[model samples]
Target: AQSVTQPDARVTVSEGASLQLRCKYSYSGTPYLFWYVQYPRQGLQLLLKYYSGDPVVQGVNGFEAEFIKSNSSFHLRKASVHWSDSAVYFCAVTGATGGNNKLTFGQGTVLSVIP
Candidate 1:
């Protein structure tokens, strides 16, 4: 079974500042990774995903994530953050089968971007 852990429960950043959200996964072999964001009163939106190929993948908006197998981490990074980016971020992982049938999610990290 695979699991994800988000060290930071909450993060605050000033508008226009760079942001990085840490995510660590526990799995024996390569697993599917995903980052999802939830805005106020909205469903979870897919920010980025990693299955194979390039270690670094670009996502919606200015969000990007890098898969570092050695560190068992898939951290999310944004060159610049906007006030609207404030939301709850979740890191999830699934087995080789793919799909959400056996997905495991982290506790989630709340991001607050101040103007």
Candidate 2:
């Protein structure tokens, strides 16, 4: 079975500070990895995605993630964060089986930024 685990349920960081969110996944072969951000009462927006090719992938809003095959991890990083960046982060995975592209999400990590 394929699954993802986010070690931190919540992360609090001050404005203009660096941030890194951890994510680990369990899968057999090459899987589609994605990082999504959800704001208050809004739908999820894709931060980044790793299907193949490059191990490190960049996303919107200055977010980047590196896909580590050996460790089965895809951790998100940002050099600086802002108060507006405060939201929930979720790590997701999808396979090639098709049909709706059902994504299995992590429990979610709520990020709180203090201005």
Candidate 3:
């Protein structure tokens, strides 16, 4: 079955620290992966995505993700952490079977930034 998996349920970090959020996906054809961040009381915002060709895609707010086809994974990364960056990050996948454009999100990873 095709699905998106986020192994980590929560991630904790201090201000000015670096962070890494992992994501894995399964699909029949070339996968389209995405990373979104949501604040405490707001909707999800696009952080990064992977389509084709380039394995690594850059996103907003100094965020970036790498799509490794061999491992069927799309991992998100940040150079430095900030208090504002603290939020729930989600990994999603599209382009599943039957031409479903709807994105399938993982359980989600909550990030807590300690100042």
Best by lDDT: 1
Q: Model 2, range 16-56, lDDT digits (tens) per residue?
A: 99999999998776689999999999999999999999899
Worst 10 residues of 2 by lDDT: 94-103
lDDT of each: 0.93, 0.92, 0.89
Task: Return the top candidate by TM-score.
Answer: 1
Model 1, global lDDT: 0.93
Model 3 gets an lDDT of: 0.89
Candidates in order, TM-scores: namely 0.95, 0.94, 0.94
**Local error of candidate 1 at residue 83 (angstroms):** 0.2
Q: 1 or 2, which is superior by lDDT?
A: 1
Model 1 lDDT tens row, 63-108: 9999999999999999999999999999998876645557789999
Clashes of 1: 0
lDDT of 2: 0.92
> What's the number of clashes in each of the models?
0, 0, 0
Poorly placed runs, candidate 1 (over 4 Å): 98-100
**Order the candidates by TM-score, highest first — what do you get?**
1, 2, 3
